[model samples]
Target: MHIGKAIRMERIFNRDTERAIIVPLDHGTTVGPIAGLIDMRETLSHIAEGGANAVLMHKGLVPCGHRRSGPDIGLIVHLSASTTLSPFPNAKTLTGTVEDAIKLGADAVSVHVNIGDETERDMLRDLGRTASRAADWGMPVLAMVYARGPKIKDEYDPAVVAHCARVGMELGADVVKVPYTGDPETFARVTEGVCVPVVIAGGPKLDSVAGLLTMVRDSLAAGGRGLSIGRNIFQAARPYQLVRALRGIVHEGWSVEQALEGLEG
Candidate 1:
């Protein structure tokens, strides 16, 4: 790794645990202003106060959510976007660039690629180009890869998830995020097949906090580096406490039960 990239990675991943808990706040660009995103600063303050490793958002949102007060968290600028209203919603297009992220003072940049989509080739091209550009600046690239599209029936299939992970590593992503394979036995295969750090994506919001933390704990046991979750964390009844629980699991090595204990008032 380039010294600069390594330095930035430290900002997002805990130096002690070599893991991260990233909260993605870029959903507004895709799905519009959702519940938790309306008050960007307050939400960011909650996340920062809860000790999240970083927050990922689009270029425009940096000014909206970047903290002026409270503890600092790493910033990852998302470079790709596809609106929910789009006819081809899975086809993500580049909305920003490495240069843009650098100017925005981002610690890293991320790209999204849906492997089974009709526009898969285009997204892969974008990922390759972005990775090369990011390398020039020694900026870390996090690839959010998913097996979603016409050909995919089960996105969480361990084989499919592993393929998604491998694609990210092959394309020079410093970190890869994919849906968890539902259990440690399967998810471990996904992580073991990739050289770069693999992080689980919080797919859809879950109704149970215990369910969420259990998933996180299982993924960690499966060798995942941590997570890049959004809705489940930001939209929780108490987002800060949720993050604190996640920190317990990701950084403090707490079991699911132990982490859940911190969630109670």
Candidate 2:
């Protein structure tokens, strides 16, 4: 990694533990202004105050999401998008450039690609090009790879999830985000042989915090990096509280029981 890249990555991945808790606010682009996102500035403050390691968002939202004073968090610009209303919502296309993210003072850039989507080829090409550009600019790339297509019966299958992670690394992602495979043993298979950091996506907001925390704990136990969770943090009854709990689990290695009882309280 370039010296500049390493320095920037440290801002997101703690220099001490090298684990990260990223709260992504890029949902507005795809899902419109949902609850907890209508006021981007307020939400950003909550996320920052919670001691999150970074915030992932679209380039346009940065001007409004930045904090004037508070704990510092790394900024990552999401470069790929597609509205939820699209016929094929999984067919993500690159909408921004790595250079644009760099100019925006971003520590990294991210792209979404679906391995089984009909447009997979196009998305892969875009990911490849984006990674190449990011490498030159010393910017980290987070490839949000998933398996969603007619052929894929179970996107959450451990085997399919593992393939998604591998594809991200093959395409040159610094970090890879995919759905959790539901159990630690299955997830261990997902992370095995993957040298780069592999973070699990929060996916849709769940009905329970314990479930989310349990998944985080199991993922860590299985050798997963940390988390790039969004809604599970931002949409909770206590947003910052949930983030603090996540921090405990991801960085401090707190057990789910301990995380909920202490930090999440």
Candidate 3:
């Protein structure tokens, strides 16, 4: 890795451990307005004040007043995107390049790849080429590897999840974001198989704060580094409180009830 890229990766890991929070605002490109994110600026501030270490957003959102306004939280530029209006939502096209990300002063770059879809081959090729370029440039690549296809029975399948993570590492991703397998023991296998750090993805919005916390606690206990929560934090009644609670669980290893009390009180 280049000196710059190595430093950037170290910075990302340090931020998450030091703060243990990531507020992902990249959902606008994939799911459109869900909730909480209706006003991006307010949501960003809430997360930042709540002690999030990084914010993942697209190129446009970053410069449009959402970039570093306060203490410099790490910025991760999302390079792949597939809007909801697209005919093939799983076919994530490369909207930006690592060179562009570097020019934009991004701390890291992320890509989305659907493992079992028909466009899987093309996406893998893109990942390989991009990974090579990123390595040359010393840019850290976060691969969001999801298993979705005709053969996929359960999105939470341990074997499939492990496969997705392994594929991302093999393609040269610095970190892999994958779904939780509902059990710590099973998810541990997936994390152990991957060469790089693996963070669990916060899937669709949950019904309750406890439910969200449970997942975070389980994933972390199972050997996962942390989380890339989106809707759970943003859509919560109190975004800052939810982020703080999550940080307690991730970095401090606090129980769900204890974390909730800390945030609520």
Candidate 4:
């Protein structure tokens, strides 16, 4: 690893735990200022207070979310995007570059690629190009890859998810994020097959906090590096407490039961 990339990786992944609790705050670009995201500074403050390792957002949001006064946190600039209003919403296009992230003082750069989507080839190309550029600058690349197309009956299938993760590694991502397969056994397969650190993506919001906690715990048990969750952490009734509880699990090795107990306390 390049010295610069290694240094940035430490910023995103806790030096002691070698894991991360990343909150993606770039949704405003895709879904239009949704709840929990309307106030970037406040939300970022809460996340930082809760001890999250890093936060991912688009280039435009850097000014708003990266505040002057707060506990420092890592910044990952997302390089790909497609609005929900677009006719081909699943087709993520490169809207920024690794150079853009460097100019913005980002610790890392991320790209989203939806496999099996009609524009999968283009997204893969973008990811490959971004990874190459990031390497030149010694910046880490986080790849959010998912199976979300007509042939995909289930995005969470262990086989499909593993394939998505492998694609990210093959293309040169330092970290890969994918939807968690329902259980640890299945999810382990996804993690075991990949060389890069694997993190779980928080898909849709769930009804029960315990359910979410359990999923996080299970992923950890299955050898996941950590989480790159957004809505579940940011949209929670208490985002700060939720992230603190997650830290206990991700960094402190708290079980789901222990995490829930801490969350309620």
Candidate 4 residue lDDT tens string, 40-77? 89999999999999999999999988788979999999
How does each model score on TM-score? 0.99, 0.97, 0.94, 0.98
**Ten-residue region with minimum lDDT total, candidate 4:** 61-70
TM-score attained by model 3: 0.94
* Global lDDT scores for all candidate models: 0.95, 0.89, 0.83, 0.94
Tens-digit lDDT string for candidate 2 (48-76)? 88889999999899998777887878999
Query: Which ranking of candidates, highest TM-score first?
Result: 1, 4, 2, 3
Cα distance off (Å), candidate 4, residue 156: 0.8
What's the TM for model 2?
A: 0.97
The segments of candidate 3 whose C-alpha lies over 4 angstroms from its true place after superposition are 15-20, 67-69
Higher-scoring candidate on lDDT, 3 or 4: 4
Find the 10 residues in a row with the least total lDDT in model 3: 14-23
- Candidate 1 C-alpha lDDT tens digits along 1-265: 7999999999999999999999999999899999999999999999999999999999999998866779999999999999999999999999999999999999999999999999999999999999999999999999999999999999999999999999999998999999999999999999999998999999888999999999999999999999999999999999999999999999998888887788986
Best by lDDT: 1
Alpha-carbon runs more than 4 Å astray in model 1: none
lDDT tens per residue, model 3, 1-265: 5798878876666544632356678888888777876777788888877767777888988765364475566778988889778888889888899988898888889989999888999899888988999988889898999999888999889999999999999999988899999989999999899768888888888887888898888887777877888888888889888887877787777999998798779
lDDT-based ranking, best first? 1, 4, 2, 3
